[model samples]
Target: MSRTKTRFAFVCQSCGFRSPKWLGRCPGCEEWNTFAEESERVISGGSSARPAVPYPEIEDLSLSRIDSGIGELNRVLGGGIVPGSIILLGGEPGIGKSTLVLQAAEELSRQGLQVLYLAGEESAQQIKIRGDRLGLAGKHLFLASETCLERFLEEAQKIRPNLLVIDSIQTVYTESLDSIAGSISQVRECAARLLRFAKGERVPAFLVGHITKDGALAGPKALEHIVDTVLYFEGERHQNHKIVRAVKNRFGPANELGIFEMTGQGLKEVDSPSQLFLTERAPQAPGSAVVGAIEGSRPMLVEVQALVSQSNYITARRESNGFDRNRLSLLLAMLERRAGLHLLGTDVYVNVAGGLALSEPAVDLAVVAAVVSSFRNQPLSAKTVLFGEVGLAGEIRAVSLAVTRIREALAMGFKSVVLPANNLPLAEGVPKVELVGMSSVLDFMEWAG
Candidate 1:
């Protein structure tokens, strides 16, 4: 009998880069003090060749999705949950990731679907307390406090649940790995095993993932690639509204947004998120501009607020919340060069109201409007909504779904819409609203004045 030799290697926790020796800084992610030692077992044996199998024939099988009984969650998932798919849900601590999943599990159980929830982070009693508080019956919802991947799989096979949920994949470990739980090797192996089980059993599984301090998912980047969908739950802890944004999906459309309100009962779906976002807007305030934004298939109206002030430091500070900083810099340069806005020696701060992050280019005009409005101390029309892409030459470019955005603005009781000149013809048929089209940013400034 030959003994197996063991080898140890240092792994970067951020990117899963492996090295023979430990280092102060990881070469893969350039993160300091992220390398940790992990053990690997090498078995001494001759290479064995395996026969390759032919490709399987494709079948015209219809895959029916399971309704989670949560409209907001379903929207983010691009519909209901698909069978035999693995979904990864990540969020910051105390941002209601576990609460959202628990509510979904209860809803599925109420629909007579067997759901096995493996609690790796909390005890069964703790989950029960939360479930009971959330008014869950738990009739078909099975709870198991297990952390070992192999044992969980064995139990799952015996019960044969329709859905499986691991309350955080960080705590789950495999016996084959010598590294502790939550390590790079452990997370990778455990997720791979779970993926196989989900595919083989044709059971839809949900894996709750932990996010690092920097807000990225805390594991190897490959972990996200192995999953079928990745949903990010985002919101401030102090805020009442929570946003679930889909960053990746294999069965549905990516970049879908789901809105929910955190309440004492549980998370309740917000049907009209636009109204919720603009409920407390100061209509008469300067530096505030309303933008008609489209999130996924849903159209919404959001407020963009900006503040410009004299710089007290040597270099002016440029800051943005819920918006890209680099993009803000580009817009500032455009304002200075094309729009003749002297913002070079001033501090500029931009924020998308209601904790919602806007990334689409349609919001460029609104951001520029808000910044200029603040700089000139002029208040924009409260009932006027803006949506268009601002070019480097100060041109207002047309955006997609112009009619959709116009309809949403109309529904929100906005009287007039300031849009790109090219979209005016497309939206001319939209009645009961005035369309103010601008060919350039300079034209918009003159109109505003």
Candidate 2:
């Protein structure tokens, strides 16, 4: 019996849900108009099957790492890049994803290692122009502008470089799949093949991915799962600072972040991110408060600014930047109910300084303080820092890594810290710092007053 050459199905772009027929809404993610027809080849007679190989002994296997020579990138990758690992780098366009990878490739080439960079989106001349502008013309660095997955893989095999980078996986397509490049089927298959090649050939690979309108990776969800590490480049395009954060890592810790400052030369690592974040902070400004946040194992100080004013419209406006909108709403409600603040006819705006997104519960106290401060038009002491979780019942809660937060704050010359009363005992080492412990939101309001 002969097998069909191709089969088709509707796949949801948002959730990677596969269905035989098209639907108005995806049952998985509930996203509308996200399903697209994808075609895959049907193989017969097991002709393309790989012969089974014996598993290696656990004690005999060894893992080696390569340093990308960029300290910021290395730290986010958990010390160094592991050989045979597939790293998925995703970000918004113009957020320095390509610049970062190209810089790392140049650094790797400088370490006497060959690097194969496949630029599927840009032409060879364009890449050369960028390389020349960035002063990254390395003898060992090889570039090829190809979108065909099979040919790219063939060239990779021929080069046998230490590091392989696909400028973007979305732009690379396979001949076996009838779908065009950037489609779900093509991205999944191309990534699968590259992952196999990386592991089988023991060459580290980096796959650049584009994000969707919803800010998720543009390809199928399987693309993130198949890779060993998923790194996100986050920052505003107009802003000079950028952050590379690791969301998932099989070999190391997740949520690790690396800070960089984009310059005319290239991405420069920020050694003192806390200082950089607070460099331009107005010391005696109302609605501004400093909070220490821990990203992975690193602790840093961030400024939280809020504005509370009379609402012009019937429904009060609530806006937040670099902070959760829902959380801001919750805090506003708590300020009214628990702190005895009259916020009914007010428009509130909150922003985290330096384009830093803070999700830690410890920042709750800071947010409340900033909002309340703005309402009262009182300026918090610039020498003070605060961090704690606020409960719905108006009680302040202790946060993890209290000791680390205090140490960082004190090192930055902040003499006073407002934390949960229960966490006062965690401040054992720092006797020189004054700690004002608050047990509830009511007490915090009084203290701020």
Candidate 3:
């Protein structure tokens, strides 16, 4: 037999660039002294067992999906997994990214789909030990502990499973690509091959992606553009709750989010997000207030907390977590200039409880209330919820979906809602809920006092 042709490749380690010949500087990205060697290039076979079928005379215009039984995950995936779709899932290290996918695969396999989970990081026995703990027992499900793309493909073609999951893409190696497995060139190429296989064979594939030090999907920026859906697992790992947010979805709305609480039984859906927000609430605490913010169509009532004390240093130690510090400073300045808040000697600390990052300006009014409540040693009524945008002029400005926010508060048994006066008429005959409108932040303070 003729010897298989092998070519050399020079790859940059820092920038992840691959070249046929060694170079002093990388042409793709300017990183020095990072070039490495590759002996052979990955090759894609010019063959397929299945032939493409022509579209029928009857137009197929709608999507078809079988539920994965996880409502939260389904919502993020644009209503369950679509056949032949490839999803790129990324999260910080040790953030339960692998666990969530593995659990979903087991559930799908039990639902009569031929599922195959190929793990490059762990062996088959290792997967089973965890699976046993999860009580995942399926007769039709198959597990492979291989990492090479060629061997995985050979087994995949033979099995022809309905659902496929590669534990991670970075650990997978392909001889067709002349670069390291996790290199930009290799990753992009491997993903392209798998995507083709998915589309051509009508197999839904889930690939776990790694995040870089900068907390973005690792590999070339182009990798993000290629995937149909990108799901991010976000949360403080120590926290019981995990938020899977859909940063990009071709089939669903971008603002939709999924909430899962990690437990002994595995990740369970949090049906009432409002309760979860108040789980760790400290009642009657100064600088603590309930705020209703609308995220997409969902309304959430979250607690905003702040701490106030005398400043010793020249800089008043103004800091905020889960909320923007710059915005916090601006709000403080507005309070001083527009609302007459004394800030020359006071230190302010603010946090959005439960490790959530709140960027919605609707929380502005709440932040102001919490800070003032702390400063004045007062607490907002537990039965009340506040919603409004704070302007540079200290105006209690209007926020979007104010009516919806009020309705959410009402549904959560809140008796009154503080809102902008501009939001009037109240969604046509809403009853039993009091709406207190304020024109300025000072007006709100007086009402609170």
Candidate 4:
């Protein structure tokens, strides 16, 4: 008789980094105490080889997508859900990941499509209650409350549904692996199996994934790579607005965003996100500036607010919300060096009106204007909008879609715009909006004063 062998390894909970011995910190994500030990059974068996087949000639098969009856969702999914594509949807707990999936499934079922919902985290009764509350009474929509991957796959094959949705991937477990559900091994193995199933059956699948404390997908990082598309549901749980953006999409463009407002019935699509973001604006408020920003091809007018005051401590504190802190520091330094705002002893704080995060450099000029307006206690015109990229050398740089931004601001009843000089030619065709082109940060400060 031969003794069976076992192999032991450590896996990082943060990034799935594997190591033979435990280390004080994970080299992958530089986190401490995140490693978990796991054992692998070494089986004694002869490996079977697969038979080879002749390669068939490639043919042109254009993409075929299914609409979920939700226009905003279809936009984020690049028109619609692609056949056989596995989509991983992740977000903070209670951030509406489950709600959005349920809504989409219900809509698809209404369109005469058979939808199979595999609920691992919730019971069938709970799901039915939610569906009832959402007014979902589709006979074609089927539900199965199970955590075993094998059982779910069997039921899926038996039903042969047009679409499949796993309420969550983190809760599912497979009997073949000894690891518990949500473990690194279990997550990776289950995701791979589901991807294979979706591809073999040519059915689009949506998997809800749990998020970690740091707001990343709570599992092996490889789980994100195995899926065809990755979508992130973001927004404050207490807030009414929720944003869905595609971080990775093999079939369509990345960074595409879809906006929604949470309501009693379910998630409602926001037709005009820009207007919703600026609905509570105060008139003629000092330190408030409107920025014409383009988020995923949609032009938006978002309010940027700044506060500048004497620092109580020796070192001035620079804080930001919905904006980058380090970028704020650089912009402040530029303000002192070039614009001569004398902000060295001032504590600066910047915030976007809504919970929307602004990353595009086009809003740089707006931040500067807001800070200056706050420090001087002067209010910018309520009808004026500003957008331009500010450089370290204090020069203003042109941004893309200048005409689109101007038109969106003008349509929103804004009359004036401060833009980069180089982008003036692009917006010259627009007559209703007054475009003021500035070459440098100093020029903008002088004009505002």
Task: Tell me the TM-score of each prediction against the true structure.
Answer: 0.95, 0.94, 0.85, 0.93
Among the numbered candidates, top TM-score falls to: 1
Model 3 lDDT tens row, 335-404: 8888788976899999988777778899998999999999899878878889888899888787788778
Which residue pairs does candidate 4 place in steric collision? none
Q: 1 or 3, which is superior by lDDT?
A: 1
Error of 2 at 373 (Å): 0.3
lDDT of 3 at 235: 55
User: What is the TM-score (0 to 1) of candidate 4?
Assistant: 0.93
* Local accuracy by lDDT, each model: 0.89, 0.88, 0.79, 0.86
Q: Mind giving the per-residue lDDT tens digits that candidate 2 earns over 314-419?
A: 9999999989999999989988998779999999999999888888899999999999899999998889999999988899999999999998998999999999
Error of 4 at 73 (Å): 0.8
Clash totals in order? 0, 0, 6, 0
Model 3: worst 10 consecutive residues (lDDT sum): 213-222
- Candidate 4's C-alpha runs over 4 A off are 1-6, 41-62, 220-222
Residue 71's C-alpha lDDT in candidate 4?
Answer: 86
Residue-pair clash count for candidate 3: 6
Determine which window of 10 residues in candidate 1 has minimal summed lDDT: 54-63
| Model 1 per-residue lDDT at 170 | 90
